[model samples]
Target: MSNADEYIRKLSFNFTLSYQMPLLTIGAYQNPIAVAMPAAPLAAAAPALAPGQGDHVFGDVIGTIETALQSIFGGGAGWQTRMQKYNSTLASLWTALTALDLGHGALPPIVNRAGMAEPDEHSHMFGGYSHRFQWQLCELVATGFVAGPTGANIEVRVIGGATKAWRKGVMARFDDLIGHLVDSTALAFYITSPTVIRHAAALVRHSAISLTAAVAYTTGHNGPGKLRVNTVLAQYASLRIAFESILLRLENEGGTRAYNAVDDSWS
Candidate 1:
């Protein structure tokens, strides 16, 4: 698997373990060290408080653990930034493609200048000499034209000679459409994931912050218990919504025609 996949898997494991740990266990780690020792007389009567009081419960621990995981596996801020860059690129490409006027008309004829004297004949015509106009004819593939062995704009055909063999020209047309879609979708995937990765990081950070605050409160002499934990958990509801929003956006984008066009099974 890829590094990102492995990292995410590890993070998932961490999250699972964090939630599995009992609140009392976590509280025991730092609480006993931080909390003031009760007098001998009251010590016997005072209830033992967990590390984050009740606030660092199963769910709370999971949140903090996820954050730590993100920090370690995601290369801290770099992953987030990378995702942002890709997401922006996808958005920009989408904008450009959508705004462009694919002028509706016949496909321009291919002109031969092999024996021509005056090459200026087709110079002023549509899709003349400029590589720029040629690109418009196949912008979808144009968007994703990668370098080949000879440094030419080349595309790979999964089924060789299928383009010419197909009498209906369906295969070639589909190939062109699919190539364009794939490039566009790739751009979208790159750009959109950053938002999710960043949001996930933020969620983890928020949880950690909440846990730290809870630990502080619990270590205090007059700290409350369950009430404080509930309050902190409630604070994360909105963040959860934000995370969901990113996931939803990804789902929506994945279902788009642009995405389908670029997929391996586009035909």
Candidate 2:
């Protein structure tokens, strides 16, 4: 088999294995769905990475993956640099998704007060039964429908209300960003070998699909539920595992050797 064929096979195998591997936990916030209601504004439990920390991590992952692609599909001068530009964009997209997840989790629970109303002794004057009223109040309070003074206060913040629309906008932008990267990569590979472009394109598509699934599972809920939250976390873990697998394969196969080589017509 040719170099490209061998590379593609390795890529496929790694991706399959990675998909089945255990979920990855990034920092303290392993589960994006489990964002706690902050006493202050909604913020991820893990503080933002210090200044260049995020960039360093993004660079390591994106740089390795792009280098591997360069090895398999030769690109014109500066192609790798051009591809690396998307690293920061990808980081931004991740940040946006995390923020949206946290914001959604922090929304106040919707309480229905009518169900909590009880028909008490006073209700007899209104032609109702006292026992029924007394019983209903106890049930509602017990079930958390009625919050006492010391109970957890639920306030609907203005930001919480706008999260739904904000989420839509974030997802839309994610599509655009990923779409651009795919198109750009395809163009780079097309200049070298049209057939090889298919392999590169497929790799990107798989990665994109994983990430899109993560975003979809996250946005699937406007409010938190146990099952939905778990789904979102699982999807994210899958995405991380997939990328890490690719990076590992690239490193083992000496893909970084192509980083300084320029032999295509992508310019």
Give the winner by TM-score. 1
> lDDT (0-100) at residue 261 of candidate 1?
14
lDDT by residue (1-267, candidate 2, tens digit) is 555434434533333233312111221211111122112211122221111210100001233233323322323464345334423343343333334221124431111111222212111111111122222111101000112134532111000111234234333432332222211222222223333213211122111122344345335534323243344344344444443343333233321111111121111
Candidate 2 at 243: error in angstroms? 2.9
Model 1 Cα lDDT, one tens digit per residue, 2-95: 5433433443333223322111121221111112221212112222221221111212222222232232112245433422332454334333
The stretch of ten residues in a row with the least summed lDDT in candidate 1 is: 199-208
Q: Measured by TM-score, how close is model 1 to the native structure? A: 0.22
Runs in model 1 with CA error above 4 Å? 1-55, 60-77, 88-223, 255-267
Q: How does candidate 2 fare on TM-score?
A: 0.19
TM-score of each: 0.22, 0.19
Error of 1 at 136 (Å): 39
